[model samples]
Each structure stands twice: as C-alpha cells, then as structure tokens.
Target: AFFITYTYPRTAVSFSEAMDWTPGQLSGNFLLPSILEPGQTYNVRARLETLEDPTQETDTDWGVITIPEAPPEVPPAADIRNLDFGAAGGTYEIGER
Candidate 1:
C-alpha cells in the first residue's frame, strides 16, 4: 500500500494585532535615534507578528531612506549705524535722494 500527500500555501494572516501605514506618509512619531546624522542610508521595514504562528509573520518590503543634511546656521544681522534725519521741516529732507 502507498500514500499520497498534498501541500498548500497560506493566503491570509491569522488573528493578530497589526498596523497598516500608508506609504509616503507618517502616521505618528516613534522613538528614533538620539542623533541622526545626515547623508546616510537607513533600512526601514514594517512587520506584523502572528499570534498563532510567530514564524509565519508578515513583513513589508525593505526600504532604503537617505537622511538629509542640516541647513547652515546664519548669524544675526548687524544693527544700522548712525541714521541722521533732520527735523520735520529742516534743510535735509528725509525722503530726498
């Protein structure tokens, strides 16, 4: 006597708490590195752990995010020097030249 076997692939996720975040958008803020350096590539991915089967969890496609460099800090502007303005009706007109 002989026996036959059949196998099928899983098509759905089991009961578990998971998150589905929209691409190119931020749902909320999460803990980030204390200091994030600029001009660097970081690996980003979303995961969904299965309650029934830990090994059969789901993971989003891996993503590469490049950090941007911080803009240069500008110094405060200097104050205007002596601005001589004659009296209301004096010789030197305020709006002249």
Candidate 2:
C-alpha cells in the first residue's frame, strides 16, 4: 500500500485501496487524488503488509513528487480600433453606450 502526505497545512491520505491478492503478485496500478493542486510538492511512500509475520518493519523511505504549475492565461486581442466616439449622432447618450 502507498501513502501520500502534504507538508504545509498538514494533510495525509492513503493512495490505494485494500485488496485481496494471490501469492507472487508483484505490481499494480494506483490512482492519484484529484484534490491535489499544481505547484505543490507531495511526499509518497510504500508499506508492506505481512499476514504471516506482523512484527516486521513495513514502511519504505519517503519519496518526493510534484505536479508542474499550470500555464498562464492568455490576454484578449485589441478588437476595437481608435474610432472617434465624440461624433455621437444616435439617441443613446455617451454614458448609456
């Protein structure tokens, strides 16, 4: 099983669900939580479970992981040109427009 921890503001979460596995099963997939934000680093580690011997050391060394920051927002293009609004002829006032 794997665990995830965020240092600042103090949050900890489990990465995988409990499963029944056959002997000799080696690898499996894990899904990351959607609540994780970009530009923040997280700590991860794996733990072993033993059915036969419960007293063994189960935890691995902590590893660092991070998601890259999201891209910047694009600014809109200058659509309207320098037209003279002083030449007002319509019924609408200058403040109304």
Measured by TM-score, the strongest candidate is 2
Model 1, TM vs. native: 0.31
In angstroms, give how far residue 47 of model 2 lies from its true place. Answer: 1.1
> Where is model 2 more than 4 Å wrong at Cα?
1-26, 64-97
Give the TM-score comparing model 2 with the true structure, all chains together: 0.33
Error of 2 at 86 (Å): 50
Worst lDDT run of 10 residues, candidate 2, spans 6-15
Q: Write candidate 1's Cα lDDT for 1-97 as tens digits.
A: 5533322233343332545444443233344453444565455555445657768755556552333444344566866586666656558645957
Candidate 1 accuracy as lDDT: 0.47
lDDT winner: 2
Candidate 2 per-residue C-alpha lDDT over 6-58 given as tens digits, one digit per residue, 9 for 90 to 100: 33332333333464443432344344666666666666665554534546434
